[model samples]
Target: MKTRSKIEEEYWEALERLKSGTTKSVDTKSTRFKFTKDAVGREAGRGKGYVRYERYPLLCEAIADAEEARKKNGPATPTANAKLEQQKALKQKAIGDYNQLKQEYDLLMTEYLNVVRRNFELETGLAETKDVKIIRIPNVR
Candidate 1:
């Protein structure tokens, strides 16, 4: 029933001992968790050391605990929730833009048909140019 903090503190202490070369040879993880012989920093040995699961069991456990908590608490942090909200807003805006474009297209198509019908009626002598009616919409933009 140890808390996450307790497990983490012990892990760090053990890691420090291993890195300092003070940990006993009998310890099962002494070799596995030993600090890499390759030096760090620019041109010291090779590349920067990265954390590996086998060498950092406690860290992995802490990460696993966080993931489990996230499952129960919805998202892990406010930043993640904020990102989700941002995605939702973007999707809504796209849908709104699409709907607006669709309405404009419908309006333009209707206007074109009205003009064509009016012109046909006048040319066929079915009605005078003044007698034919074409729709007028104001302030489209």
Candidate 2:
């Protein structure tokens, strides 16, 4: 088993490297940073406010492994088994992350549309305000 302290230390180190700006090797992808206002103040904004790097992929793979383990173990396996339960929990977390990203992407798209619509409205001197509203409804299971 990996030491949690070591894991946490590494996590913080990686975060610090990120915070301090790590060197990007030639192979690394170049991404743009945007400036945006927050409740506190303006801070650097990720294009879509998404973390799309090593940790994201690792989390995704862990979730997949968990799912596979769950399927392989089947209903006969005790659901309370620590490993299986942990895997299930991780899978749920990944799903939640995916859902959250989807929602955020949808919202950004809507915001982009509104901005474009308003730009066109201004250019054409149109008084139509119908297309500026954003409506979000949650699905009930």
Clashes of each: 0, 0
Report lDDT (Cα) of residue 4, candidate 2: 43
The C-alpha lDDT values of all candidates are 0.53, 0.47
Off by over 4 Å in 1: 1-78, 126-141
Q: Please give, for residues 1-141, the per-residue lDDT of candidate 1 as tens digits.
A: 545554345555544454344553324232232133211111121233433466556554554564455357453345888989989999999999999999999999999999999888766674445677655579887
Q: Candidate 1 lDDT (Cα, whole model)?
A: 0.53
* Count of clashing pairs, candidate 1: 0
Candidate 2, poorest ten consecutive residues by summed lDDT: 34-43
TM-score of each: 0.34, 0.31
Write model 2 residue lDDT over 1-141, tens digit each, in one string. Answer: 543454434433443333344523111122332111110011112223243335354533443454465456445534568778889899999999999999999999999999999987785554455656544589999
Candidate 1's TM-score: 0.34
